[model samples]
Target chain A: MSTLLAFLLSNHLKSRFVIGYTLILLLVSSALFIFTDNPQKGLLGGVNLVLLFVPLVVSLYTGISLYHGEDFTRVLLTQSLSRNQVYWSSTGSLQLSLQAALLVGLGIPLLLFAPGMPAVALLAGASILSLIFSGLSSLIAFRVNDKVKGIASLFLMWLAFTLVFDGLILLFIQLMSDYPIEAAVIFINLLNPVDMCRIVLMQVLDAAALMGLTGALLTEYMGNLFAILSVLLALLIWLIVPMELSRRSFLNKDF
Target chain B: MLHVDSLTKKFGRLEVLNSIQLEFQKGTVTGILGPNGSGKTTLIKCLLGLCHFEKGNIALNAISIKSEKEYKSYFGYMPQIGRYPENMSIGDLFELLVSLRNQPENELDLELWELFKLENIKSQRLGKLSGGTVQKVSAALAYLFKPEVIVLDEPTAGLDPLATEIMKEKIRKESSGKITLITSHILNDLDELCSHIVFLNNHKIAFSKSMKELKASRQGLTLNQIVAQLLQGEA
Candidate 1:
C-alpha cells in the first residue's frame, strides 16, 4: 500500500503531462458549473466532457505510465517484494490516482452546482470508466513490446471505442432497418464500456428522449434499475478483466 | 551463496543463455565478463526473478528459487543504467525505498549518502541529474539495505574517478562474509575488486577461475594481460 502511494505520488510530482491534465480537468469542470444556468444542462455538459476526455486521457496516461516506469518496475523487482506486490501496487496506484483525479475534476464541480442523485451516479460512472481505461492501457502496455506500436494501438483502441464502434453500430442499425434489431442493439451496447456508460447516464437523467433508438429501447425493455445495474455490472467486468490480464502479463514479463 | 543449474533463456529463436551452470560462494566477489549480447543481463535478470527461464533452477542458500519470492530478499541489485522515477527527488526516492522495505527511520544506512555528498543533492529530481550522479544514486541504493547478496551490473560505468574509487572501496569492504556478483567491461575495475572471474562467450561459460589461480598460472601478468591472452587464444 505504501509502495503504491509512493509510486503514484512520484508520478504526480514528476510528470508534466499529469500535472497539466489535472489542471485542465479542474478548470473545465469549474467553468462548466459557473457558466451554465440549468443544473441539468451543466450536468450533461460535464457528462459529455467526461465521456469524451476520460477514456482518451486514461488510456494514454496509463500506457505511458507503464512504459516509463520500466526502470522503477525493475527496481521494485530487486527489492524485498513479491512479483504480485510489485505488479498490483503499480497498477493499483495508477488506477487510484486517476480515479481521484476524476473525483476532483468532476465530483467537486457537480457537488458544488448540482448536488444530487445525478452527481453521485455521474461520479460513479466516471470513476468506473477511468478504471476501465487505465486498466486497458496497462494491459496494452504489457502485451506490446514496442513503445511506438503500443501507444499507437492504445489510441486506436480508444478510437474504436469512442468513435468507430458506435459509428459501426449505427451503420449496422441503419442497414438492418427492415428488421427488428432492438434486442440485438441492446446486447451490442453492453459490449462497449463507453456505450454502457452513455446508457447509464441517459437513464439516470431520465433523458430517454435524447437516448436515440437503442437507448430508448433499452430503457423501455429493461427499465431504470435493471438497465443501470446491468450496465454498472458490465463496467465492473470491463475493469476487472483487463486488470487481471495486465497483472498476469506483467508478472510473466522480463524486465 | 548462489547457485544456478542448467539455466536456459531465449528470445524467439536466439538463445541468450544456454544451460549455464555456476555458483558463487559467500565472502567472494565474482565478476561476470562477456562480449556484447552474451546474456550477462539476462543471467542477472534470471537470478533476480525479473525474467522467466525455460529450463534449469536457481538456488540461494541451498533453497530452490522456483515459485518462491522470499529468496530475492537476500539480493540487492544495481542495473547497468540507473533510472528512478523521473519526478521524484533524491530524498523522495530514498523515502520510497525505505517504505517499500518496511524499515523504520532509525535503521536506515546513510553511509553512502554521506560519502557521496548525496545530502547536498537530495532536493534535486532524478531527471535533472547527470549520468555520473545517477550512477552514484544507484550505487548508494544498492548498498543501502546491507543484504547478504549483491549484484552490481557495470556499477561504476559512468562514475568520475573519485566516485569510482569510492565505489571500489565500498565493494572491497562489502566483499567479506557476503556474495557480490558484478558485471563490467572495465577489466581494471574487475582486477582491482574481483576475487573470482567468470567469462561468458557464445551463450556459455567459457571459463571460470579464481583471481589467484589465473595470477599463479601467468606470473607477473596483470589480469588485463591474462584475459587479453586468453581471448587471443580463443580467436
Candidate 2:
C-alpha cells in the first residue's frame, strides 16, 4: 500500500507541473494571509482558493493518469490482490500522499505564522478539507472517459463555488437586509464546505468573536457552543457524503 | 487454466459481449481474433475483472474471478501501450514494483532486459524515450514477473522486425509452458505463436479451435485464410 502511494506520487511528481503547483499555491496563500488585516479572514480567502483551485487541479491530474494508465492497471489487477485490497490500498495511498503535500504547502506555513493556534483544531480543519475535496475530485475524474471533459466539469464546479456562490450569497443578503435573520445565516453557512471551514476555524480562535459579528446570527441564535460544534459536525458530513458516494460508484464501476 | 461462461456485458444500450463461453487449456496460446469494437477488448477486461458485466462467471485456475485475488498472482500483462512514471529511471520504476510486490531476486523479470537492450538507458526517464522504446519497456515490465499466465494486447504493434521476432519467441515459449492470451490483428503473429484461436464477432464467440483442428477443418488453408473465412461474412 505504501509503495502504491509512493508510486502515484512519484508518477505525478514527474509531470513538471507539481513544482509550479506547490509554488503558486504557496505564494498566493501566503500573500493573501500576510496582506489581509486579519490572518483569520485571510484564511477565509485561502479556503476559497484552496477549495476551488485544488479540487480542479488534482482532478485533472487523476483523470488523465487513470485513463492513460490502463495498461498499468491491467498489470496490477491481474496480480493476486482482491478487488477490496486493490480499491482501498490505491485510494488510501493516493489520499495520504496528496494530504501530505497539502500539509507541507499550506499547513506547515500557517502553523509557523500563527504560533498561538492549537495543532488539533488546525489539523482537524485541514484533514476535513483535504478529505472532502480529494475524494470528490477522484471519483468525478474516474467516472468520465474523456480527460478534458472531466477536468472541465471540475473547473466549472469550482467556478460555481468561487464566483457564482458569492454572487448568490450577496443577492440573498441584499434581500434579507432588513430582516437580518439568524436561521437563514446558519443554514446558508452549513451548506458550503468553505463557509463551514471558516466558521469552525474562526470559532476556534474565539467563539465570542463569531457571536459579536453584525448579527452574530449563528453564535447568538444557535448559541456559541452549538454553532461551533455544528460546524465541526458539518465538516464530518462533507467528508462522509463524497466518500460514500464515490465508494459505491467505484465498487461496481467498470474501469 | 481460465474459463469464461455466459459473460454478457452491455454499456447503455450497446451490448458489447453476449453470452460468450470459452475455456482455455493450460500450456496453449489462445488468440482472441476480432476486429475493432468487436468485443475483444471488452471480453478481456471483463475476464480480468477490470470491468463489470451484467452476466458472467470467470475463473482462473478454478478460482472465481469475482471472489479471488490469487488470479493476480498467476499472470502478467503487456498492454498495447505502456505508460509509467516518465520522470523515473527504468531501474527505479521496476525497483518500485519489486519492492511493492515483495519480490525476491528470483522473481525479478530480467528475461527481457537483454532483449530491450535496456543497459544503456537504465538511468534514463520513461517520458524521454521514443515510442518503440516505450513499447519495449512495457513488454519487459509485463514479462519480467515470469507469471504463469500472460496476456499481451497487440504485443508487436510498434516493434521493429527483430524485436517482433524476439517477442513472438517469448510468447510462444510462455504459452507452451503455461497459459497465454493474446489479441492481435496480425495473422502472422498467430501463425508464429498461437496454438489455438478464439474468434469473436458481434459480441459472441464465432469460432474456437486449436490450430490443428482449424487446419483440418479448412484443409490446406493458412491461419489468416481460416480467420478470413470466419470473419468476412460478419464484417
Largest TM-score belongs to which candidate?
1
Model 2: lDDT of residue A142: 58
For each of the candidates, what fraction of the native contacts does it recover?
0.74, 0.82
DockQ per candidate: 0.65, 0.65
- On residues B109-182, what C-alpha lDDT tens digit does candidate 2 reach at each position? 68788877887788998778887887888788778778777888889999999999888887776666678889
Worst ten-residue run, lDDT, model 1 chain B? B101-110
For residue A83, give model 1's deviation from the true position in Å: 1.1
TM-score of chain B of each: 0.95, 0.94
**Where does candidate 2 clash, by residue pair?**
A78-B72, A79-B72, A79-B73, A80-B72, A80-B73, B109-B144
Tell me model 2's lDDT, rounded to 2 decimals. Answer: 0.72
Clashes of 2: 6
Off by over 4 Å in 1: A3-7, A13-15, B67-69, B102-109, B215-235
DockQ of candidate 1 compared with the true complex: 0.65
